[model samples]
Target: MRTGERRPTLADVAAEAGVSVALVSIVMREAPGASAATRQRVLEVARRLDYQPDSRARLLRSGESRLLGVVFSVRHPFHDDLLTGLYDAADKQGYELTLSAVTPRRDERTAIAGLLQDRCAALILLGPLAPTAELATLADRLPVVVMTRAVRHRAVDVVRTDDSRGLQLAVDHLVELGHRRIAHVDGARWVASADRRQGYRDAMRRHGLEEFVRIIPGGSGEEDGARAARLLLDDPPTAVAVFNDLAATGLLDVLRRHNLDVPGDISVVGYDDSSFSALAHIDLTTVAQDIDTMATLAVSRAVERVAGAQVVHRETVIAPRMVIRGTTGPPR
Candidate 1:
């Protein structure tokens, strides 16, 4: 607890509480993701370890102008995961993230404008929906690093997962489970949705399940999955690969409500492997985007550009991995 000694950190508290650093962060920030019991335990661990977050202090000590503005969607659980990593990355580089959230009512423009007003040293956008020209315009003003989405603009640095590969991985897993009547619930019109959709098609064709290729209209939220589930009920597939975990949760809920035993009746797969996927109740088999690598590279690129370093590459694509969980099973 002494000031001169190395201070306890979120990692310390997480280790003590048998939880993840991300969960510790959520507890520390009083975020909504944690359960009340878990929150109490995390708080006790923090108090016991004297763990205090120095991120804000570090930012203030460094300077107000050293902030990295980050634009992300509030609705995406994956964004929350990346935010935790982004904070750690920024902290390592003596910078802090200033976040602008995109809600249902607030558009990306509004989020970006808020960051521009903050006068951050650089901007790192997470799966931004802005057009190439708009991103280019923003890049002309300052360094911009887009994460979790691909862009062709020379001025922008993109750090994203091979989203297509993520879908392919999911499809492959389901196919390996001897599922032929496999369908996909796609991320409709989202920036990364197109690649994910195509990946599904490619994976299905590669497995000679081309005749089984069916795409259900889905989106980035639980509601979208819930709606898609209704359609799926008419003629259910043996397995389904969803666009993302958020949507997958919705689909799971609806399927369960209809007395369908997951994996026994219809196996479900999701992308992003967001924290909730690992929960015992959800236990979603999913494809994981490399959040740590993506965040580190995104921040690294943004910081380098801010430091006036020469751009080496315009984009970085991290690989995806499949997480085998209880949600997936051989066709019944």
Candidate 2:
């Protein structure tokens, strides 16, 4: 044996872990294949030896960056959750997720091109506002995944809540509580916005309360909610269902200012059972998105494509469940 030589490689770690070299590779690349027990063993041995995979060397050998580009809306709670889930899933599969914040002013094409310049193998856009055609065009160039948004393009994959159904769940709950006149705080510009609006109208008509439907223009944020509440100050409805919990907080604040009791004089419902919705102070009645399933599926789809597996252009619409909390009650 030579007196001096280079340190051990994945082959060494695999031998030490009693696993295959390919399994060790999967652990480093974050790709799918190995079982959880094998992955843990390989990772433990790699850690004990302070083994660092030469990413540059690996990329050169594999002709893949093994990098996933993630663009999320800044400072958004839902986006934050999506990012956390994306990261966890990507890490488990041995994939590196490189993140960028999509500033409102930047167009989708420009943001995506920047990610491409960084050599990302794929892109995941959180709540994108791009037209379906543009998204389809992007799919032609690379594998792309859209989260919290809908796309009908056969080339791209979408993961989002069934917004129409989520809205119906909100309306039916409010109507069951003897609420005849129920107003809705609308979602902003996007696929979700339009579908949710229709759902609210449909549910109202289904209950034979079409005359009671009122639409208030508001985005999915606390400020928008506050503004919506102020708009209804003069003639507040018996109940209100907001677009999301962020806006619901604003509505609650404004309601408190006007000396109106929630669920007493003006019951309120919110969407997206985000962390804030469950807060002791907020306790908002809201619709819950299946975060774990959405995250897992998004990652799995992306990884499948990256692993040279063909994925059909499709969208996964997970159902939303209504969560009853302190903010809603019988109409007074």
Candidate 3:
């Protein structure tokens, strides 16, 4: 509305529709009392007046809100996929998602605080790196579902793919291709990196490739992958399973630059089968998480908790599968 222009209210809509304020409210909220003719009339009059309901105020007055808060990292493309699934899942559960992103300069705490201020009914955190104590503390205040990471806290709900199983799948795929001297690039700085790293170790030992097992430290981005790839130059392994797709892309770039043909010289696999993995040029073989299932479960848990339903299981573990593509082959 323009400055000094009074915003149209239910009183205005009622006056225009030649109905009582109570009847207009009933029509607006789709309550049972309003007849079809009166409902249509009030809607038309409200539209003509460019009237918009203050849903927040209405929800607050009713002592309930259907808003579910989502906290996610801005840098991860996989988070984008989860978000798409989350929106659909929330809609199916009669709720809406409000987003708070964790950027390089913005912390998760700040994002969460904003959601709290908005009076969110529950919180869903994607790949949260918050301390166990802190997460537990948050759960005490409201329903909190932590996604993509397993937390030991009982109060908080967990919806995640088995990170260790994902890494094991990657290693198994490489070993089946006759790759013995397999190496793992670890994302130690990330939330589930430790689990993935341990999985790689367990798989390598199970294959009796213990002597050839190599662990390279990696970080969250493409450069970290590139850095790990550069470190392997002196004694490159027959195959490498990277932490995540973003870092794997960096590793691929470095390998290509050094004239090493992927799958021929060294087979590579990444985690998170992200959006870029299927690109024509970057067809990376990687581990895929069921984003739809995870998102749906997260939303369900949040909604159930908000509705005071009995939560049988606090942690929901989903499986991961390996997507075979051009980046992986029998190492020659």
**Candidate closest to the true structure, highest lDDT:** 3
lDDT of 1 by residue, 1-332 (tens): 87688888878899999999989888877779999999999998888887777755544555757899999999999999999999999989978789999998999999999989877899999889899999999999999999888899789999999989889888888877799999999999987999999999999999888999999999999999999999999899999999999999999999999999998999999999999999999999999988888888988898899889998788999999999999999988
TM-score of 3: 0.90
Worst ten in a row by lDDT for model 1: 55-64
Please report, as a residue range, the 10-residue window in candidate 3 with the lowest summed lDDT. 54-63
- The residue-by-residue lDDT of candidate 2 on 1-332, one tens digit each, is 13475677888898899988888998898999989988888889998877888874677477768888888876468788777788888888788888877666866667777888777888888888778888888877788898888887778888899989999999999989899999999977744888889899999999999888899999977899999999999999999988888888999999999999997999999887887778888999998888878888888888787777877647899999999999999986
Q: Count the backbone clashes (under 3 Å) in each candidate.
A: 0, 5, 0
lDDT of each: 0.91, 0.86, 0.93
The TM-score measured for candidate 1 stands at 0.82
The true-versus-predicted C-alpha distance at residue 237 of model 2, in Å, is 0.9
TM-score for candidate 2, residues paired by index: 0.81
Q: What pairs collide in candidate 3?
A: none
Clashing pairs in 2: 29-94, 30-93, 30-94, 30-95, 31-93
